[model samples]
Target: MHRCTLSKEKLAAQPGGEWTHSVSAGFLKTLGCLELLSVVGLILPAVLDIAPVMVPVTAVCWVLLLTGAMITRGRLGQVKLVAGDAAYFAIAVFVAYGRFVIEPFSS
Candidate 1:
């Protein structure tokens, strides 16, 4: 979420920003909003003891998101970025599996 927010800021500050020029500004904002919602889905449902199943679902979504990022970075020939995305994907997978089958949150 923080990174998405920063990317939005970068896009706003410089419409033709080098790093962001590859993607549309509107798409960046949408991505940021989606990330914010994913965070909420990650925390609120479980914390409030309402629809706790959403926690693992959100984690799975994160895995998909990070996987897409890894693929994109790989295609861009950004090996370093792909490594970081892979790490994030692994963590998300761990959390998803843990919540879904290991120590699931009680509803």
Candidate 2:
């Protein structure tokens, strides 16, 4: 929400804000909204026991999002940042794998 709602100046004032310069505000806002929805999809359905299958699906979406982030960071020559994104991508992949294979939620 912060990234979607904050003014460009305010966003640029944040930590690691320099990366914001590499992308348009619209892109940032859209990414922020998608990320927010992904977080909800990851947690809410499982916790509420309504549609726990969404957990793995959302994790897959998160993996895709992080892949884009890694590519963007890599293009920007931010190798260190790409490593962080890769770490997150790995975690998302793990979650997806665990939910889809190891202990899947049955509908």
Candidate 3:
């Protein structure tokens, strides 16, 4: 994982790891940690029915994160990567809208 690897060379060895060079390891690790937590926030509360509203909140957070990702990729002229980010952004937006408006879980 790029986040765990301290050596730039080691990170570059992995597929798509070259992107790690654009940012500091600390930033990457922080981002990775946040993403991991966002995933947990998306699933755990909903599954346990403890705070299902967190699912939509997490989805909204993911959308914001992906928006930053898309801007970064676009600035780097990574058109293909931007497209992928757009797809993820769309999915996050859909999830947020669905959970918040269409089928929100009742408390």
Q: What is the TM-score (0 to 1) of candidate 3?
A: 0.84
Clash count for each candidate, listed in order shown? 0, 0, 0
List RMSD in Å for every model shown: 3.6, 1.9, 2.2
Report the candidate with higher TM-score, 2 versus 3: 2
Model 1 residue 60 lDDT score:
99
List model 3 lDDT by residue over 9-67, tens digit each.
Answer: 67656654567787786787788778889989989998898889999999999999999
Clashing pairs in 1: none
lDDT of 2 by residue, 14-47 (tens): 7556778867889888877888899899999999
> Tens-digit lDDT track for model 1 on 16-95?
23345577767777887888899899889988888999989999999888887777767767787788878888888998
Q: Candidate 2: where is the Cα deviation over 4 Å? A: 13-19
Model 1's alpha-carbon lDDT is: 0.78
Give lDDT for model 2.
0.86
Looking at model 1, which ten-residue stretch has the lowest summed lDDT?
11-20
lDDT of each: 0.78, 0.86, 0.83
lDDT at 6 for candidate 3? Answer: 46
Task: Give the per-residue Cα lDDT of candidate 3 at 74.
Answer: 76
For model 3, name the residue pairs that clash. Answer: none
